[model samples]
Target: MNYTYYGMFLWLPSVLSEKGYSLVHSLGYVLVMTLAQVPGYLTAAWLVERWGRKKTLVTAMILAAVAALLFGLANSTAMLIVCGLFLSYFMLAAFAGTYIFTVEQFPTVARATGMGWAAGFGRIGSALAPFITGWLLGVHLGYGWIFGLFFAILLVGFVIVVTLGYETRGKDIH
Candidate 1:
């Protein structure tokens, strides 16, 4: 859930306007960032099998944090786009890993129930993020602040995944 808000809210064009990017360029960059997630998802699919769920998730979380931090502190448009691309990559990868791990946490009997609740509750974060971000942006908090908050939230997700996440790799799902 920690990441759900970020995934839903960090529409790069909207957020990058504060990064000193024009709407057109920001939109282009954001489009690239969004497209970049495909590789991350494919990577996660591979890593979840090769490296196992926990490692894949942890790696993605750390990378996501770094990317978000860089995006927040970036001064150049080039840097901003670079960081945003990586941020989306890792964030989506982490989300994919966590989602699979969550589904694997339960037996077949309860897998549907578990997924339902996880998805249901996860939407709360998604629903709330725009509002929170709107308020933050409206207050003239700056792009740094917006991205900084996302960085912090990503850390929270990292902690949660590292501390509480169980390895489901190689375990039978049936």
Candidate 2:
């Protein structure tokens, strides 16, 4: 999720320019997409309380993956904007839920260490994303391929969550 989100957003403007959009338009689109993050995080906060952490993260991952795929396939400007907006929204929401969920899993004594480590490991993905995305583009893989890769990764995350993740919702922390 971090890889996909950071990779796509980091390279989005360049991708748009390569797709023939003017730099100004590309930046404008990116701005609009980035602005969606605020509400996405807010929504995650609400869903974490209402739907629980696991469900919120899983749902956000799935939706973000779909939105990314759709954004890649989009031919019209409107579709691009709409799909981009959704992709940004759900990705950030997933991150928000992840922060809340991960913290809840640790006992107080280890909470800081656990949170720091988890976040640090996640940043590894973020750090690698730009390089990989650049390589993908350099190799001439199309947008569909790029976003399809993200879709696959997100599904893997969903599976990991389903298989290994236990609900932390309403549980008493040690």
Candidate 3:
């Protein structure tokens, strides 16, 4: 998740520019995509309460994957913006749910440590994304290949959550 999310933030402007948009226009598009995060976070917050953490996260991941695929294939400006908005929304929503869910997975005594380690490991993914994205672009791999790779990663995350995650929606923290 962080892989794709961070990749987008680091490379979206470059991607846009490569598509022939000017620097200012690329930035504007990224800004519009980023603005979608607010509602995304809010929606996740609400869904976590209504649908629980695991479900919300899984839903976000799946939607994000689809958005990534579409964003890669988008040729027109309108499609690009719409796909970018969806990608940003679902990815940020997943982040919100993940933070809440990770904390819930640990008891009070180890919660901070668990969160810290989870975050630290997640940052590893974050750290790798930019370099990987840069390399892929440098190699002249198109958006299709780049985003297709992320699409697979997001699906792997979704599977991990479904198979390994437990519900913590209403249960009391230990």
Candidate 4:
């Protein structure tokens, strides 16, 4: 989770530069994205309990993919900002739910270990994102392609969660 946001920090400046935006404007994009995290976290907490965790996670992943696609296709700064907010909301929500879901999927004895391994794997991807983004940008590929890639990743996640993840709508964890 931390690495995901951190990856964005590495790419924001370069992405803004590609769009010919000022540092202030670039920072605004980051700020908007960050601010969306608050509601996202809250929404995840509320909805995970109300809806099933699997359903919430799949929904969030789908929404994130949509937002990423929209941001990729955005022609104006305002559109990008709007998409950023949507992306942040879905990303944070899906991340929070994944943490809870993964822990719940394990027995009491192995829950911590399971969560730790899953989180570690997520961090690896996060760590690689900056290098990947930098390389893509170096090739002069547009932001559209970059975001499109993320959208594809999210889509795959959504499919996996829906098809393979167990439903824990009311499972008790001690």
Which candidate achieves the best lDDT against the true structure?
Answer: 3
Deviation in Å, model 2, residue 113 alpha carbon: 2.3
Give the per-residue lDDT digits (tens) of candidate 1, residues 78-116. 887788789888887988788888888888999999899
* Per-residue C-alpha lDDT of model 4 across residues 10-121, encoded as one tens digit per residue: 6876687678998887887788787998899789988888997888888988998888878878899889888889888988998878877778887899888988998898
Q: Which of 1 and 2 is ahead in lDDT? A: 2
Clashing pairs in 4: none
Worst ten in a row by lDDT for model 1: 1-10
Worst 10 residues of 4 by lDDT: 1-10
Clashes of 2: 0
Q: Write the per-residue lDDT of candidate 2 for residues 28-135, one digit (tens) a residue.
A: 999999999999999999999999999999999899999999998888889999999999999999999998988877889999999999889789989999999999
Best by TM-score: 3
Residue 21 CA displacement from its true place in model 2, Å: 0.7
Q: Give TM per candidate.
A: 0.90, 0.95, 0.96, 0.91
**Which candidate, 1 or 2, would have the higher TM-score against the true structure?**
2
Instruction: Give the Å shift of residue 169 in candidate 2.
Output: 1.7
User: lDDT for each of the candidates?
Assistant: 0.79, 0.91, 0.93, 0.80
Ranked candidates (lDDT, high to low): 3, 2, 4, 1
